[model samples]
Target chain A: DTAVSQTPKYLVTQMGNDKSIKCEQNLGHDTMYWYKQDSKKFLKIMFSYNNKELIINETVPNRFSPKSPDKAHLNLHINSLELGDSAVYFCASSQRGGGSGNTIYFGEGSWLTVV
Target chain B: SQQGEEDPQALSIQEGENATMNCSYKTSINNLQWYRQNSGRGLVHLILIRSNEREKHSGRLRVTLDTSKKSSSLLITASRAADTASYFCATGSNNDMRFGAGTRLTVKP
Candidate 1:
């Protein structure tokens, strides 16, 4: 069974359109995170949720928002998408308590294309 | 700019040879981790070394962390063709994790 899973493996939409990506973790982890990898392959952390509470919120634009209804699910919604929004978004989850020594499990990733 | 930048963005080696990649981060971290990503796939966790731990090993993978210098290195011995992938280093402070650009390793037969 997959530990972390994401929905909509590929999404193509036009500008000014709204889209949402869903993520779920089966590791029973207390923390989950969202990351974006651009064309340069530079990975950037967007948000993190601990036990359904928002933790780390990066300097991402307001158009991008993350909603975590619970510890096992975290969804990302992008509104008024721009051409620069084309990239691969990854969702990861990790157990709490042990810190960095705790291994993180990643999802297959959702590829978003803004036309 | 991204934290935890890797060196030698690309490397190619024979299947029997060893491969090493280095990463340097700007801030002190609680721990550092190494992950491998196949082409167009999600990352696979390889190893994790705590700040107090200098070295860690798993199967044929070896990881070393130098907290004083805020750097880490991953070495794969007796590499195989399956080892050809992108290796990334991630540093975590608290529960937030960030990854480096990663080094693409191509192992030929």
Candidate 2:
């Protein structure tokens, strides 16, 4: 089974439109994260949730909001998306404690293109 | 802010040759991990080296960490064409883990 999975492997939408991507991990992990990869393949952490609690929130704009209904799920919603929003979004999960638990497992990724 | 920065944005090598990638982080870390991502695919965990360890080996991959310098290196031996992909270094401190821009490696068959 896929350990970490995200919906809409690919998405294309017009400017000003709102879109949401859902993510879930079956690994029974306590922490989940959302990362954005730009055209240059620079991956940046947008948000991180530990056991449904917001832990890390980068300098991303308010247009980007992350919601975690439970520890195994974290979703991202983009409001009034701009052309700069075109990038690949990745969902990942990892255990909370130290040691090997720090290893992160990533989903296939969702490609978003805002026109 | 990104914690790690990989040296040599890109690398090319022939099969059977070894490829080395270096990573430097700004802050102290609990552990450092290397991940490989193919074109249009998600990142896959390669190996992890903790702050207390200086070297680790898994198969043909070797990882070294120097907490004093806050840097790490990943060496891949006997490279194959299938190894052509982008490699990333991530630094984990407490609950926050950050990734670098990554090194794009092209292994010519």
RMSD for each of the candidates: 1.4, 1.3
Candidate 1 chain B: 10-residue stretch with minimal lDDT: B91-100
How well is each residue in A1-115 modelled by candidate 1, as lDDT tens digits? 9899999999999999999999999999999999998877778888888999988899889999999988999999999999999999999998972255788888999999999
lDDT (Cα, tens digit) per residue for candidate 2, span A18-105: 9999999999999899999999999998888899999889988999999999999999999999999999999999998322437889
lDDT of 2 by residue, B1-76 (tens): 8888998899999999999999999987778889999999999999988788999999999999988888899999
What TM-score does candidate 1 reach?
0.96
* Cα shift from native, residue A49, model 2 (Å): 0.3
Would candidate 2 be rated incorrect, acceptable, medium or high by CAPRI criteria?
medium
lDDT of 1 by residue, B31-59 (tens): 88888999888888888888889999999
Question: Individual DockQ of the candidates?
Answer: 0.63, 0.59
**lDDT measured at residue A60 in model 2 versus the true structure, 0 to 100:** 89
TM-score of each: 0.96, 0.97
Give me the candidate number with maximum TM-score: 2
Candidate 1 DockQ score?
Answer: 0.63
